[model samples]
Target: MDIKKGYIFPKPFWSSLIDVNIRGLQEECYEIRNNVPSKYKSNLGQNSYHSPNLLNLQNPPEILKLMKQITNCIQTIHQQSRRENVRLVDFWININGKGGSNVPHTHPGAKYSGVFYIKVPKEMKRGNLFFLRDYNETYLTSQENMGFFKQGYNLLPYDLPKIPVKPLEKLLIVFPSWSPHSVELNDTDEERISLSFNYILFR
Candidate 1:
């Protein structure tokens, strides 16, 4: 199957298992947040540095099990692609509260990146996942060659497309790593819990 650019893959086959473990981890992380003292919490902007205050799971036995399931899903896609191999470099969770958001940025040095939404409240007004349009080369070419009769060139200011927050229970979104993306701030009082991860494909 030829996956189109910016195509959001259907929910992976093993997502049910992933959802179960993610729910368990989310509950545990929530409890930890409530008990632990956090000196600073995220505000509405790009993350400057990863917080030690937040739980960072790299190779926990439970998380590893979850990662394996995710890896299997990614591998299934990789096999269909021209490339036949892939690797999961790392995975981590982000706990965003009201007003916390990430600025537009692309994953550095990875082939594919994605996020699995765990919790989304009903009151959030503006929080959504956004993907930047791939336009850098096209922009430069258009600027150099002023074409009056270009076939498909519709010149306009570019804006990233936003994926609205549906009932984000078990939604897993994957996109190219070079695709710049961001998360909008949660305007309401509730928190948004999500897991962001990346993988490197060996061609």
Candidate 2:
């Protein structure tokens, strides 16, 4: 169990499981912006759909089945880390359409969190998930100085070293729960489907 700080678990493929879970989810819930007030209506407003927590779903059997598969995957990761005491919070599916995007945020009080991209539409121009660097807050402020400062004098955030999005099929991206991350807006006209979940590690 040698987990390094900021360690990323390699992407895992669970096509069959994903298919089953997504099928059930699609039938069960409609897409809504994550964390937005009920009165809000706009794709640009913190865009992302969150399914009800799996445990609270009206159809518990289907939700339970999906939970089992998700937990099994988490168990496998824990086994590899030789860490057995991992407890998963319920999972949520995120459905995004053209112009939809998620704001930067972290999962509070969880050890690790991850997303599984089930369906990535071909039309998407910039729908990749992005992880924020430790300096993002300062970097964003620096962007304002670009107009007044000469080239190279103004620090552009992207010019600084950045971790690139690692591509994979049916990608499962795992990171510390508190890591800031976001999904770039889907500029193209198509839907993006994904699921995110959290887990706590106990000794």
Candidate 3:
């Protein structure tokens, strides 16, 4: 007898390290964090600073370069024509210090979201990013665990509950805006600095 299986319902994210000045980006974030008031909070918790929208930057050349790369990525992900541009609706900085973490949340109103890491703690798992499976009774009654075949360590995306994306300097990641996700605590002494933005296809 012969047997076969089918795959379905896969969630996806795109990530890469673009050719940009990492040091310059880091300095830019620090400058914003120093001058901007982040007294109000959103998803960020303890020792974290969330900057106001960065679209207002007068002439941040490095940041503009990064934005160009991000737009290119969005277009690539969607297989869109390079000439067709998407609007960068919002842009901001995130600085997470020791004990900083983000609550589980999803971006609304935007079609896609992304992040760019500038400064990350040398210690792995410090402020780790995680992608969570949508809340549901998925595979509740399936006799076999989806994450692994009852034998070898081959992993499947469907069977897994969540995915942890470790932060690394110069790393950039993009995913559906509706994807639920969060961050782990930054136990290390250093701060983890990253930029985040939302985008939508041009109408």
Candidate 4:
């Protein structure tokens, strides 16, 4: 049996855990939680500190340096010829505790969005990120027509309706702004801290 795989409109993204000062980033999160005045409560998460604009804010030198590196990494992943033109537009910090989770949402105006995981509980239940696949393909390949293909390994791997992504400390995940994604409930008592950011190209 010979089978050829071809991608029609495959969604592509990038993720990695780079070497950084995890402990220092964790400390910075705590400081933001304690000192930041703005608290974003619209979402279902436990608590979120929304910065006005990370690029405009007078953040610590260390934090700004890391953001620059993240932008470079994302540019490399996308294979853009003008690497210096890519920039991170904004970013915010999120702290999800027990029973907290984010609803499905997409970035509004940015070309790309990403999250950097600083702190994750040792025992995480449902706090992982899950990307929702486009419904057109799944709806067309319903049980009525694709029932027989589900028997064994007959169906291709790209037919799934959702994709779950695990989180790790020092990890960075970058994807298109239009991708719909949500977080599961934080079952563990400890807090899940992450820095979410958006990026755009100037040239």
Residue 89 in model 1: shift from native, Å?
A: 1.2
Which digits, one per residue and each the tens of the lDDT, describe model 1 over residues 1-203? 98775634322222232455656756755654555443333335332222342224333444455567667777876676456688877665666766678777888898777777767777776778765444563454453554454578664433212334343756777767777677877676676777667789776
TM-scores, in order shown?
Answer: 0.64, 0.63, 0.86, 0.85
Clashes per prediction?
0, 0, 2, 0
Per-residue lDDT of candidate 4, residues 1-203 (tens digit): 89996778878778887788888878877776677665563347545444444567667655766787798788886566444456787888778777777777888888789888888999996788888765675566666656745356654547666688898998899989989888888888898887888888776
Model 3, span 1-203: residue lDDT tens? 79998877677899998888988888887877878887454555578898888786663778889898888788788765345557788888889888788887788998789888988888745577889876663355233543435677676665566788988888998989999888888888888888889988774
What is the C-alpha local distance difference test score of candidate 1?
0.60
Top model number, lDDT:
3
The regions of model 2 sitting more than 4 angstroms off are 1-25, 28-48, 59-64, 136-161, 164-169
Model 4 steric clash pairs:
none
List CA RMSD, all candidates.
Answer: 7.6, 8.1, 3.0, 2.8
Q: Give me candidate 3's TM-score against the actual structure.
A: 0.86
lDDT per residue as tens, model 2, 124-148: 5577677775565446635364334
Candidate 1 residue pairs in backbone clash? none
Worst 10 contiguous positions by lDDT, candidate 3: 137-146
Which of the two, 1 or 4, has more lDDT? 4
